[model samples]
Target chain A: MEFTNALSIATPELIVVIGAMVLLLVGAYGGDKARPAISLLSGLVLIGAAVASATGPLGQAFMGAFVNDSLAVFAKVAIYLASAVAILLGHGWMIRNNQARFEYPILILLAAAGMSMMASAGDLISLYVGIELQSLALYVLAAFNRDDAKGSEAGLKYFVLGALSSGLLLYGASLIYGFAGSMAFDDIAAAAAGAHGTSLIFGLVFLLCGLAFKISAAPFHMWTPDVYEGAPTPAVAFFAAAPKLAALVLIARTLGEGFHVIEDQWRQVILALAVLSFCVGAFGGLMQKNIQRLLAYSSIANMGYALLAIAAGTTVGVKAMLVFMVLYMVDVTGFFACLLALSRGGRPITQISDLAGLKQDRPGTAIVLTMLSLSVLGMPPFAGFWAKVYVFGAAIQGGLWIFAALGLAASVVAAFYYLRLIKLMWFDPSPGLTDPAPRDAQWVAYAAAAFSFPLVLFALGWLDGFAGTAARALGLG
Target chain B: MIAAIAFYVLAAVSVFAALRVVLASNPVHSVLWLITAFFSAAGLFVLMGAEFLAMLLVVVYVGAVAVLFLFVVMMLDVDFVKLREGFTRYMPFGAVVACILLVEMILISAAVAARGAGAHAPGVQHATDVTNVEAIGRVLYTDYVYIFQAAGLVLLVAMIGAIVLTLRHRPHVKRQDIHTQVTRDRKKALAMTRPETGAGVRPEDLV
Candidate 1:
């Protein structure tokens, strides 16, 4: 890996890194004066990086520690775009709450860069580095509102648990390296093919555990509710969207590419995780009064659906995973945008009751939220429905009928909560949350809402085709 | 035979210190025990022929991390009784978790051992002439360069996060407003005029 080659391959991350560092210095010196400019610049930098990442030629770099491929490009673009929108949605909230510090955007940029790295990671070392980079920034972002005790508590909890998971991940990587005699995915796959030793199986289990924790799969999703409820709404929005996408991709890479030789073992583990996650996500969200926590549970359940495709252990399964992730990104981005608009008197409207009669107050916003919720429920004609179709289709195609059936049941259970939210908006009497939606939130809300629709027309051919192409590029097919 | 004896001594000391780190009642003693554990672990690393790792363990763990732990233990006013109170209440669950972890470790080690001796070595290949640090440098700089930079970014985020959490400006506190003072002009900030020496400062001038 020559210097220039590495630079070219890592242009997206480098752009974000350089931009974040410069803005960090500028923010430090400029103080309160340069906050808005820095934030705007942060969004632009993300967009620029997204463009850079999308245009780059596909190849491996840094002795195969870093890869530039269609899969990486797709994941990076989703992360960068979702993060950029998240920044925009969060900007108004940060300003309103006096939490618009320069560090907020810089940390977001760093996290996005880390996500990009995760998308492109080719080896265990790179994977660990990417996960840590993203987690560290997220730990800060989770507690960005330091004045709030809940925020501090969320940050601390996330940090401790996150650190533990990272330790587990690193230990697993080390174990795998020991067994395989290499850290590269190719060599690990070769080693795994040769023999299925107990150590190798244990290492794979630990690795899956760590990845499951990252994606908030059940049994490891303890932190999701508290962190979501405690963190700023905008940060939570970003949290619910981008990190899950990146983590899912990394799981695909690690398991599908690296540990594919032991597909039987890993597939069972993934199926069990997916089952638990679906049940937990569905049942957990039912009693949630806090809307954020409710969304948190929904996220867990959604991740379960996403994991189903990967559990199929086929190229089409990977393709379905990509499709599911892209649709999820759209739905979550819209959902959070609507959430941002639901605030009143500079304080976020966190309670489900706070959204009472939202339809009368802000009909357009309410309708958009209803649509996003419907999509999330996997109702027909929405992106979320198609996302589910592809994943369940892949599962059935791979003969995982039990998993697919359980997933369908979970979707029905989860739909109740989504419908309840919509019902509260349209039928429930007014609680006087008449404050207008924040500036710039409407655009994001509309864009996300628009994407959530038109799925039926495009998903089967275009989106599936695109995801299939990317999955093939990774040698999945 | 001497080398084997040294390795056994280091390993036993490390294991003992590690147990003491958890069992010791006093927080200060626990920190000290942790340092001992770290030192003996470094010795074990050195015995394994990874001198670079040994140096790092000593420098990073013993030198910096343990000292920081000691300072924190001494600085905080901790309620040892309260800390131990939950021990009995949570003992069953904690013990179950601990037992599970122990079992998992035993299983992993047993499996590794079953795989035979070659599995114990590090994966990276190196020239015999190269030093441990040099070999590490080669791999880290070439193969792991991006990861190294990512680690640096992680540290940067941690630094900024700490500062963000602790730094605050109270509104009521009287602090120098450098910008206001520096921007002030003589005409706006001061009234200068000729006056009789005996007149001193007038009330209007003071106002």
Candidate 2:
């Protein structure tokens, strides 16, 4: 009976892993022609696993290593959906560049599997495993375009920084184990509640630093821009969306579950990181010429917003984070879809200068890019605006007025860069470069834009219910 | 008592070899030192009764990776003479750091020894039936399961990071197109050809 229960709980992760393995084998044998089918099949499998997770019992499983709950289900759904869209956006580029290999979809599926595992991780060990699984897949994906020098450089930079962070995390885990005598989240929590020692505190700080790097929060975000800029655009799109969502959920779970007793110790650390992330993300993006790098900084800022919600440690804050992340994912996907469609001869047109006069050559894509960029800048009637409003409101309700104010200031600073992109797209003259949108690329752009539209229209209705459900799931009244 | 002495000796050798891994002048020497370190570490692990990890470290790290490292180092055209020239400049600082580290280790060991043997905590018994490996495995698979899993993830990330850093694409070079190669006609690539005769060409040339 216990074995069956464990299997049931582990089923979602198992399904994705098995699917990924199958894809890997197919890639090994099927050659280039098998890429599209494999990609679609993997995407469908991810969606299926996410849906399956939703129907499972809502509690810890596998001897308290994995959790199956509404929160995990929700995060899994978001990650899977984003990954599916990213695969779709990548397809055209892959085919055009003769890179439509089986490895591409398989790697994406593996990464998604990792994120799914992370979402369900109920203990420290499981969390680290999930995080590493996802990160490892992503590292490969980041430099998948092995022929591109920049891609290789990006991969190298990400690896070096990532290894250092992992070491820090391991040391932190060891310290925590030494202090608490257990690696289980509940055990750690119990120990922390009884005795809040210096070693435990230091361990928690290091742990947070490791997670902060994953989320690309400030002081630990130096790798974000370089990695994003150097990675293939589709990989960047995946990086900016799914992993951030998963990492944020993990952070929330860690703080809310393990360190609930020592909130005073961690709250200030989170707040400082949140502020730095916001400032850097907002202001740093202003000078970026590469669209991908700009989005990377933007992702850092957005993650900061999510962190703000997590830092609140209120039920409402958790709910707000879920809503904010969902909306952020949609907006970012739309933005990347536009960028992906603007590529020429399989090479991404990432520079801000390349986007000049885009309106004249590809009016539809330009319009979508404009809306997405505006939404990113938090314009009214867009999904991003409502997401920010709810998050900032939650901050205020939690009496974190200073954080709210800083967020608002950062948002204003961030607006200049988003608007600058819009201005170049609409007002600048076309550079007479051939339009890069093949037939399939156009479809991806349309799908992304169409998805963003509904998100905006349904934001109010979606937020109320999603927030309530998330709040309840988080045990916040 | 014999086991303890052997364990201490192996540990000391492992530490010494590891130090030499960093201090050795030539890259080849460094790799050799690393292999030695692995062997000593494995021996220490065996003394601690972790046969699996010991065997794995020997077979995988020492036998394969270290050997590969040695081979690569041997192949590279490293200017060992230049590398030696800088040794004098940094030796004093390096020695001081090493001394500090040794002192710290001595203090830690002395503290632990002072704590004495069989100083078991209350309600905690040293198991008599299971070996150290089994004891550790039991704890790892049960109580510390999450951490064990987390460690796996860290390794996975490291593996990916290593692969990504080393994988580079060069476009200018002429490379075989797998697609074209797979579909090529055998006759086109391996045909029996006749020699061409030119003006004033010899009969041997024509043949």
Candidate 3:
């Protein structure tokens, strides 16, 4: 590919890279004093990249190894937006803890760039590279506080489990190459359609296992709680929202597009995974005292819902999944925003008990948290509710009523934990510990909470058009 | 042909050293074995025409990861003396397993050799010009693109996990507060007291 064409094709990533480098230079020169300004600049650059990706021409590039399709464009936009929000939420926490450093924004930008690459990755090799870039940046971010033992332990567990998953994925990729004589998704689809082999199927199974780990899908999701609990709150927020969305999209792109021909083999595997994820997500959150761990379990269940839409393997299913993911990201971001706001002294307030009587102390944030928590549980008049409905509707259309029923049951189980959080915030007595409000955190709380109201109100009207466009873009119909 | 033979020999050495990395009793020995394994792997890569990866493996993995292992083992208070105590008991079973693995490898090699050279060779068109590095680059940038991308993501995740695992927060430890330390004034932190030498007070106490 010509350099200009490559630049044009990779503009989103290029923007982030340039921005990160400039921030790093500025940070080094300005020392600790320049971190806030650099972080804000990085956030703007991320927003710009998201906008550029949305407006950019959509197609394949680099010999079809990277694709710039509507689905990729939309997913990149979501990833960038989430990254921006994460940076905003993290700014206050970093400053308060005196851990605000140049590497923070740079790593965030690099991770965002990686996620963007992952979203558009058209071939397995590109996909692997994108994921590693994202993962490496995140690893640093997770353990950025070198003095914290818990943070270090979280990073270690995540590394070991992540390495094992990577090994599984690489072995699967080699097997796929061996069986299909090609690693491009398009080529694999064509090869697998005509050929029959056990190796190919086994490779697919292993590949799914790796992707499952990424999205924190059940059975492959052992590392989620420990990692979430161990990392700093903002890092956990970024983990819970952005990477999971990218992984889900990549999973859909691979299975829904590339392996559509062998749906019979993968369908059962996905169905089993979906059921397992749902049960685990619901039941796992119940016993969690730490809010971050609770959210981790919630993420698992949410992924199950997203997988349900994917399991349909229809165009409607793809659109529904996309809509669901977008809404879920917003809802989860809002929830984290509230958690980030609930600080005592200079430290972030964590643990379920820490949120007691938040309704009295921080009424606005508590209200937003309640709405967001309700949305997460699939309550009506919220974006998550509509997202779930579309997913269930897709499932029913595909005649997977049993899965839909399981989803409803899981939603109920999810509600129990979310409601417990709400009760703690409202019904419980106030701890009466007061701390000065951090300006940046207050803004994040307002923004996250305010964003959800419109999401809830406009979800129904928004879905039909969004779903139609997504369907057409994906060639689902 | 010579290059191919060298590659095979290096590859065998690398595999043997890697096996030793896991089986060696002393952590220090395991690290040393790992360094040798990395060197042999690098040599094989060079023969296969991956000059960049060969250099990277030698410089980064051997120089950094293996050295880190050695340093960590040296610094740790592990009793190497006790580790050797159980080796004799496990020797017979280990030997039997090694023999079975060797037999399987020989059989696999014979099967591959029976298929002949041309069976596994590239097509006639551009075969001479298609160096191993070029072929790998082509496949990586094209056919195996997603897998390559995924590998990077895995590494990134592993890196993050490592940091999270090692971070420590000690609540009770007394550490220097730079802000407070830097802002201290001589007038506030230090006092010059003048005591009266009277009313039966000792001179030392007054001073």
lDDT of 1 by residue, A1-477 (tens): 377987998899999999999999999999989999999999999999999998987888888889888889888988998899888888888887778888888899999988988999999988998998899999999999988999999999999999889888888888888888888998888787775444577788888888898999998999999999999888998999999999999999888678877888888899999999999999999999999999999999999998999999888998999999888888888888888877777567889988889888799999899999999999888988888989999999999988999999998999999999999999999877667777688888888888888744655587777788778765754
lDDT of 2 by residue, A137-196 (tens): 888888788778998888778877987887878877876766677777878787777634
- Model 3 per-residue lDDT at A361: 68
**Higher-DockQ candidate of 1 and 2:** 1
* Rank ordering of all candidates by DockQ, starting from the highest: 1, 2, 3
lDDT of 3 by residue, A308-348 (tens): 88888888888888888888888887777677777776567
Per-candidate Cα lDDT values, in order, are 0.87, 0.79, 0.79
TM-score against truth, every candidate: 0.93, 0.83, 0.81
Candidate with the larger DockQ of 2 and 3: 2
How close to the true structure is residue B125 of candidate 1, measured as C-alpha lDDT?
Answer: 59
TM-score of 1: 0.93
- The global Cα lDDT (0 to 1) of model 1 is 0.87
- Which 10 successive residues of model 1 chain B have the least lDDT summed? B117-126
Candidate 3, TM-score of its B chain: 0.66
